[model samples]
Structures are given as structure tokens and as C-alpha cells.
Target: MRLFAVLLLALLPSLGQAAFRCGTGLVDEGDWPVEVEERCGEPDYVAVYPEASLPGIGIVQTVEHWYYNPGPSSFIRRLVFRNGRLQSEDSLGYGFLPGAAGDCNPRVLNEGMSEFEVVRRCGEPLSKRVTWVASDAYSRYSERRSGLQGVYPVEEWMYEFGSNQFRRIVTFRDGRITDVESAGKPQ
Candidate 1:
């Protein structure tokens, strides 16, 4: 019995490995976007960004994040695709029902959460501004080594709760939240 228990523990992590199921089909990393779409159907939301450009090769690598919300009972799943192939999968917080407004509470916002998470919790922002900033020294060095220039996208999403509440500004860098600030109450 003890030996069996140990073996089961060893297999636990493997059982939780990243994979998404759709009806009878399962999608895994390295699969094509078409394969994932065929199995999982269209995603609830999709965000695409250019990751890097290699001038020498005349190649631009784009990254796409496809979000699936399988209702409130299941965790939301994000499928990441790089250069048209599935690269990784992530499980996020519980999903809400379709067509329902997100349960937005500014206090819950924090750094390091993905832009997808913010959208999932707050629905759409009233206004969004996008900018491109030069990559950090480390990222620039790495990209330069590969004959690529590093410029990353930065976005600011502003949300207004109500007349009685303060407006919030959320800043995202490289697809992740970097800062959140509370603006004065709406005029």
C-alpha cells in the first residue's frame, strides 16, 4: 500500500500537465492554431502582438494569446502561439458565464497579472492607449545577439467605475500588468 501510494504521488504532476480538451479531441503544445481551433472552437478573446523582428532573415515573430472561458465551473485557459504554432498553455482563475459583465473590483488589481486576466475580471476598459518602448538592456542584448531589435508594446487601460468611485489606470508592459494607479474621481 505504501509503495502504491508513492507511485501515485509521482504520477500526480504528470496528470496535471497542460492540455486542453474539446469534445473528444485534445490539444497540446506544438499543435497548429488551426488544430486548436478545430478542437476547441473559436476562443472567447484573442490578442496578438509582434514579439520580435529579425531583419537579417526578414522574419517577424508574432505571438497570439487565445483565451477560453469554460463557464464559471472551470478555470480559464490561455493558449499561446508563437510564429503560428502553439507554444504553451496556462490555466487562470475561474471563468464567468458568457455575456455577463465581469466582476470588476479595482482593489483586486495587482502587478504581474496578465492583460488577459484584467480583461477577464473587468470586461473592456473605457479607453485604451498603446505605445511602444525600447526593450530593457537584458532583452536588447539577447535580441541583438540574434540579429533582432527589441521594441516591446506598452498599453494603458483606463476604467471608470462610477461617479462615486475613482477612475483607475492600468499599465501593461510586454502583455503583463506592471503598474496600477487610482486617478481622482470622475468629474
Candidate 2:
């Protein structure tokens, strides 16, 4: 378990300077296997960490973290795998704990995080749930994608979870947010 958490952190460029989170994100599902040599590369994740989004079914995820040998002052990379697949494949970026080492695959989000920043860390939203007349809601927008690697537009945000210091980020596609909920305390 310790080794797996380390590899997840090492993947985040920002967190690269410190340790990383565990494999809190999804990995692979359906047709993709845990083939590090095939899935990792380009964009954000490598052939090793392929995520699958299937609601309550496919939630497979993997993360590469880091570890430091206090004695030798050396760093090592580790990988962790989780079952099931999420719905979104692309990630915006990630949220990390300040001084908590690398981007340790933040199992839980930190206190402050923004929609843009979340996108930078994780990828885009594959799908979302939306509702009008609600301050805390998600909107979605999409492009006319019609190819294998379709340039599908994706975005999301969390409304209820935003206030003072903490907020919920909703994802957006063209100009709307998807299904979102709150999960933090107000500043």
C-alpha cells in the first residue's frame, strides 16, 4: 500500500517536488488491461494509469507516487491500482495538501481549490448532472465531436461546496456545469 501511494504522487509535475497521493483516481476498465507499457504517455497519464468511467461499474484507477529514504535521501516511485471505473477519462489536474509532500493522489480534497485549477490537475468531465435555480449546480457544454479521438468538449464545477475558503467546483463543456455537490466547510 505504501509503495502504491508513492507512485501516484510522482506523476503530478507540481507535486513531483514532494511526495504524492495514493491511487484515489480510477485506472482502467472494459477493454483496457493494466498494461503500463501501453496506456501511459502523452496528455496527463501514461499507459500504466488508464481510467474507465462506468458509473457504479467501471471505476478502475491508478496513481504513481514517490517515497524518500530519509537515510540515503533517495526517492523511489510506486504505483497503486483500484477497482471499478469512473465516468470521466480526462483529468483537469489535481489538488494537493500544502507541504504534504508531492501531489499525493489526494484521496480527499484540500480546503481551497478552484474550477480552473481542478481542470489543470484532473482532466475534463465526461458527463455531469445539472439543475437550474440552484446556486450549487453543474452545467455542461460540448463540441461537435465525430471522430475516434473525437474532440469532445468537457467541463464541470461544484457550487454547493464553494464558500469563503472552500467551494464545490462544477465542470463545464461549452458553457454549462455538470452534476455537482458540496463537500467542504466554508471559510
Candidate 3:
């Protein structure tokens, strides 16, 4: 039973492909190479990332993350995908600790919440109204703040939106968060 369970656990990753979404430019394993302009909004890092071979399949991907607290950690969840499958989801600690995720949940942004409001809670939106032309998808992103100097740096917070409410949130640095997509109330 234990051996079977372990095997199932290993195979589970290949299954449930729905949990994974391929990025634009670099289509899953086969299509054209994905462009950085399409993924990371407006190129603003110490150095721009270059295109590389897909990690698993033939897809292309870019990795960005946040850096922050206990474990003195990094929220910058790293990942890259070139094909219809996932290249990686190398995030630390499942997007935030249990209690922390709960604390971060504040209602999803609606008519009242301004850009500044979003920043107040989660820091800066990594990509504002980030849109992908090929599939007609979009995401609004943000990152958690970093700690004081000499501490862990690179804290990140992400909020992805499709038209409006997205289903994914990621912290690149050391930031943590609870699901906010559900204010759970009616719009």
C-alpha cells in the first residue's frame, strides 16, 4: 500500500494538467518561442532575462519571485513554461503559510478598490492589467514588501486577473497571503 501510494503521488504531477497553464509566446512544447515583453511587464530588472530551452517539455518560461521572512525566505516563486505543460512551479511553502494566507485575504478588488488600495495590502502590482494577446488572457499582479535592510530581500506578491477576477496568486519574495479572489460575496 505504501509503495502504491508513493507511486500515485509521483504520477499525480503529470495528471491534473488543468492546474497548469502555459504562457504566451512560448506555446506548450511546440509552438513559437514566448516573448519576455508578453510575460514580465515592461522589463525592469537588473538585467533582462533571455530565452532558454523549456525545462521539461519544449515550452519557454520566465521566473520571478519575492524574498522575505522566517526561513528568512524567498517569495519569488520561480517557474517557466514553453509548451502546453508546466516547466516548473518551484515556489516555496505553497504560496504562504496556513494562518498567513487567511490573514491576507481582504475582499477581491472591485469598484471601490483603487490601485493604491491594492498596493496598501499587497505592495506593488507586478503587472497592471497584464494581458496576453494570443489567448486573450490577462492578470493584475502584486508582490509583498521586503523586510528591513540586511534581512532577506526580494519579497514578491502576485495577483493575476482575467478580465477582472483571476484564480491565481503568487508571492515571489518572502511574502505570504490568503486567497483574496473570494470576498465570497456577490458583485
In terms of TM-score, the best-performing candidate is 1
Better of 1 and 3 by TM-score: 1
Global lDDT of model 3: 0.32
Ranking by TM-score: 1, 2, 3
lDDT by residue (56-161, candidate 2, tens digit) is 4442333221111111232222233233222122222233332333331233334333333333344443234432221221111211121112123233444332
- The TM-score obtained by model 3 is 0.19
In model 1, which residue pairs have backbone atoms overlapping below 3 Å? none
Candidate 2 positional error at 181, Å: 15
TM-score of each prediction: 0.74, 0.21, 0.19
Number of the predicted model whose lDDT against the real structure is largest: 1
lDDT of 3 by residue, 46-127 (tens): 1112122222443133333212122224332333332222343333432333224321233444332322224434545544
RMSD of each: 4.1, 15.0, 17.3
